[model samples]
Target chain A: MSTDHLDGNAAAGALREIFTTDLTAATGTCASCGNVATVAQAVLYTNAPGLVGRCPGCEAVLFRLVRGPGRAWLDLRGVTCLEFALPDPS
Target chain B: MATVSRGFFGRRRSGDPDLPPGQYLVTDFPVLSAGPTPRLRTEDWEFTITTETGEKHAWDWAALMALPAQTPTVDLHCVTKWSKLGTSWRGVSLDTLFEDVESAAEYALVHSYGGYTTNLPLQDLLDGQAWIAYEFEGEPLEPEHGGPARLLVPHLYLWKSAKWVRGIQLLHDDEPGFWETAGYHNYGDPWREQRYWGD
Candidate 1:
């Protein structure tokens, strides 16, 4: 049997380099299947050429982060929209 | 070139001939799926091959199990830069499954139970190249590893091996699948390092 690797939450460390806020908790809708789920639920394949986040509902790639030589490429075509929850000021 | 972290050593095995370019050797088989692992029973399982002309070939679990099974030990190379060597699997060859099916289709779109699809050339799947594997490492395949049956094309990137494979749709024209449309190479050959589009 294959080992179960980490989910989208594991990509948070790499994603922090790009986004200002944490993306794991953000809710997004899949453009392919229209299923809404938190980014944490997205399947993540990391340590590759880049970080790949796929929708849990439809299995469509939701986002990709590729770091090149002094450059970064971000593709979010598979996501229809992302809704972020603002932090509560306590 | 991207700068490497100080004292950073990749997980590459020393002098492993089976390891491909830009890939590190790993002993553990990693499970990479797009969604929840599908649990399917053998009694409810069926394999189908459909051609562009609407011709179809079907096989139940028992019929498939009764076929001549071959256990081949092969290396698996994932587009994710991980190559696992000497992995053993048992399955009926695609050649046997496609024995009597007559079609001039140049391409094939493999469909899975989870609605996942991957495309490949017809030639890539023939001539003792691929299989519908249901047993791995002398054990019944697990759902996370594409249990019941999954297409095992060890030559290409592992993503091309669609898990929970249910049917195959032969096409005269090439059609990009999930990852192919998203940005992956249409034909993911690890030997050539064709990981993304225009590689």
Candidate 2:
């Protein structure tokens, strides 16, 4: 199976779609402390590998996917979208 | 995504402070920013600032350049672990940018392309040390390095020193950006080594 079908842009777009859709919708029991929380930021960078999310109540970094299979995927992931506020200086 | 033994905010093998002293150079530009003086093909370039209250100001290149410029020599520590020191950038200070605005927000979210973003304390944004740099190495900044204009907070990790920065939006609450939302330290305090996913 030729993987040439994935352009960096296309793959990035797909990831972005995931973030806006499934990733954003994901909420589960926190692996640490067994508290329910939401994913804050899904890290896609290799050096700082992991799926980082925050506890809704304690704000602790509960679920960490550091240094594992996901670590490898983060290396190849490209930034798809950046959400920020557009404040008016006036 | 190669993992370097050296982390952006981990203990150095030499045990030197994580922060760069004052004369190091981090040149991952060209391929990273833009290669050279990206020609402004048209009179369409604009730099704007937004407030947490949802106010915005747009400035053309000339208008932005018209703002007072200051030369600040600061140490830049990148999230990738390399620190460039003694770099002097001259541009408009954020205090000057938000001078006339009477917004009461306490924080600002810096926005940029390349899927990068970071948050800045309102005080830090107003810090005279912070500037929207247009020139580097005594020349116009290269686009790859946030040419024309880029936010340079010498005190914070270079990631917080956002590249290709187009605007700063004042915020009432602390909202994380692309990297911060992921696992990168929210504040990116170099002194605290708030560098990666968790502290």
Candidate 3:
């Protein structure tokens, strides 16, 4: 019963490296508990070895990102599908 | 015609020979966290050590406070590349806690109240290397800074000094905890600048 998790905004800086657009608004379904939420709404953990994004609905990890040394590794095994809210390019 | 791109130099590295590589000095302790800090009450809090053979050694808050306390001033280095030097803290040393517990395990995973965990060699936590710190700068630890009690393994990255610490689980084999399984280096040595998985 760890009383820890972080706000979604914490992932913004690290995620910006991999995505052209803000992915925080992107919604995704959780593979474990079938929860749906935006990246920002997930229970995030930043003070670890990497950034962990977990589902707010069931606490399942939605995505994991590790960034350093000019490289980044992202694992989406906890996610089922993602629907992005990209802005219209005129 | 050619296109130009941003030539990134790298993460900010300092030339300070004393501090760890790639770290900048921070006067304030940053509130880097997993989520919101778990509210841990000392009255209800207890520290436990689970040995590999199911032997459990535990101490309630009062019992823990009964032990001798040490005042240590040490530097802290975070994996995020921030170094806080000569931080003053008062707490019970892990050596005092492990005085009676007998274990043959080689590795240990430290667990905190809010479900956060990190692993290191059992030796890292003993021999005057670590503590269950409860006070900082002559003040009770605030929740944000892992108050109630937090592991203080200053030699390693600050993450190893888990916030709101509750117990230690000794294991026969290495079991990677939160960050170790995720992307942080298994053996996070600040001197080597082992921040990420590979380096």
Candidate 4:
């Protein structure tokens, strides 16, 4: 399907609910294919049963979000590691 | 608690008798992918079946077309809670492909052209349950829908049906595939609402 929706930036709002930093600017490595890319570069599918973020290089699903009435489930098993930039003190 | 979006819920269609629990009906076939769609020529396409012992069975496009095909109308449920009913597809059955091979493996990992994988019990793929579908709605499947060929395991959540499927790896031990290892349910049965780990 055509990726008409925005990239992983579409996930920034949901992710901000759990993380203090802006995840859209974070970098991640795909555990399955070893491809590294910024979270914003990954593909996002918001129409499915949940919000699914997939790696841009290998298409491996990097994370999934399922928000319930009072709880949210975030799955990040597809990412081997994530590097978040430190805020500049200057 | 985090706020939920109402957009996540599609409108329910009346008179729909086959949808699973916690799903809404969608008229459009939404495209969901992790990466750019791989453009592959049918001439170069091949489907392989590798047994646990390393024996290999391969079929190119022509060889695959030589086999009998069946068109089945089935309902699809996505783990994300969208249901598309009566989708039609034409392809050879896994039973037809596995008829010649003899293996004792209880689990199988479906590999896709784009390095995606999903695991399932070997039994879930046999006995007229699944197909390597290449045609959707009487047209050659589109790459976005896993053209060339995609695994169709309608009974499970759609993720279990790996798109752009390339091969099947039979294994004695159950291995977590891309989604399974990533916290999606190992056996994604929509009826049971098995969308993630511990679901």
TM-score of chain A of each: 0.69, 0.29, 0.73, 0.74
Pairs with backbone N, CA or C atoms under 3 Å apart (clashes), candidate 1: none
Q: Fraction of native Cα contacts kept in each candidate?
A: 0.08, 0.11, 0.38, 0.24
* Runs off by more than 4 Å, candidate 1: A1-90, B1-11
State residue A46's C-alpha deviation in candidate 3, in Å: 5.2
Off by over 4 Å in 3: A1-27, A31-34, A45-49, A58-60, A77-90, B1-17
Interface RMSD of 4: 5.6
- Of candidates 3 and 2, the better by TM-score: 3
| lDDT per residue (tens digit) for residues B1-199 in model 2 | 3243343434443645534432233444312321122444215566678876778887777888788888887767765556655677888888888787778888888876443467878788775858888898789887667766789887777777777777788888988766665556778777666666556
lDDT of 2 at B6: 40
RMSD of each: 10.0, 15.4, 9.9, 9.2
**Sort order, DockQ high to low:** 3, 4, 1, 2
lDDT of 3 by residue, B1-199 (tens): 0011213323343566658877767667776776567887888999999999999999998998899999999999988777788899999999999999999999999998867889999999999999999999999999999998999999999888999899999999998877777778888999998877888
Candidate topping DockQ: 3
Top lDDT model: 1
Q: How close to the true structure is residue A83 of candidate 3, measured as C-alpha lDDT?
A: 83
User: For model 4, what is the C-alpha lDDT against the true structure?
Assistant: 0.84
Q: Each prediction's Cα lDDT score?
A: 0.85, 0.61, 0.84, 0.84
TM-score of each: 0.76, 0.61, 0.79, 0.78
Model 3 CA RMSD to the hidden true structure, in angstroms: 9.9
Q: How does the DockQ of candidate 4 come out? A: 0.16
